[model samples]
Target: MVGVAVLAAALLLRYAALEAGVFPLDCAGAAADGIGGLCAAKWLLVQSFLHQRLGWLSFVLGLAAFATRRRGLAWAGWGSGIAGLVLYSFDPAAIGALLSLLVLARAASQRRRGEEQPGEEPRDGLGVGGLG
Candidate 1:
């Protein structure tokens, strides 16, 4: 499913950029001032930045998928997106917001579809009184 794929891609990109860390400089002495050091730092910085952007993009796409009745994808989007956001740790409260949004959206979608669970009888507005 697209939700799973987006989550997988986001996870992979996140892991790849993990090595960048807060400070990418690991070399000692003046060697770090050379071209190789600059290149290494540049590559790591760029990768990290791009990873964040891509991760956010994946989350946005997952939300869109959910809007189209992809319940599984909606759940996956919230789970992975929250996990990644927490792991990166920008704001602790964002996870809660994302979770709440997911719940609301999923519930709304289900209501709109009017789907009945297995072994559950469909409801009718008319009661036994037959007042319609």
Candidate 2:
């Protein structure tokens, strides 16, 4: 799933950004600059990074829940996934995950009732539909 991949990518990027000098972790003597201003900056950066990571995680979990076609998971996933994406880009993976869950749910319910989708030709013995 595209959603899984995007979430995974976002996770990787989060860590990578943290370790890649996106923020300064060494603020030992920052107090000299003004009551630990450097320390405060570093703390903010780390906190933001963590929040971003949580968002990515939520997106991934939502996708997995969608794949399983669980109603509870579907609701949770959509709720958290969309919220998480609010601070990030509108990635196609999230959209895909949501749509897939909807489709899977529909298919599952139809299968349970032995029903077929509208406009779909019936299958033949050879595993083909409307083919001679």
Candidate 3:
């Protein structure tokens, strides 16, 4: 949810800072001048999230969500992946998006460890994890 909100804000920032004739695809010059905060936001949205070569942020968030089984992290990974793809960071973003889906599915289907009754028999009754 927070990720989505951040993305929305980024979209507005993109229009206002970059698309609004404020920077004209040139960030460095604008930074040298006085007006930088919005331009910095522009640089961050473009260089950091959307146009980054590797989509590292999305990749890392996806990997973390995959490893930790946290739905919130999964949401973040998914959002970043979308940003990466829709705005130019394609391949790695695909990986990140896939990882996010897997994490969400795993979180939904898997039972919590704390809920298990230590030696309780598998409810499916195939003799442990339904593997039999």
Question: Judged by TM-score, which candidate is best?
Answer: 3
Q: Distance from true position, residue 93, model 3, in Å?
A: 1.0
lDDT leader: 3
Ranked by lDDT, the better of candidates 2 and 3 is 3
* Model 1, residue pairs in steric clash: none
lDDT, candidate 3, 1-132, per-residue tens: 655675676566556655677764655664456646656656655666544643667788889999997899888888887767655677888788789879976665555534445687766434546545
Cα lDDT tens digits for candidate 2, 77-114? 55445544543534533663465468556756777867
Candidate 3 wrong stretches, greater than 4 Å: 1-38, 49-54, 110-132
Estimate, for each residue in 1-132, the C-alpha lDDT of model 1 and write its tens digit. 543665576565556554545335544435456646545654644554454642454356465654564655556555556545534533322443364356657677669977656785335322344347
Ranking of all predicted structures according to TM-score, beginning with the best and ending with the worst: 3, 2, 1
TM-scores, one per candidate:
0.35, 0.38, 0.59
Ranking by lDDT: 3, 2, 1
Error of 1 at 86 (Å): 1.8
After the best TM-score superposition of candidate 3, give how far the Cα of residue 2 lies from its true spot, in angstroms: 8.9
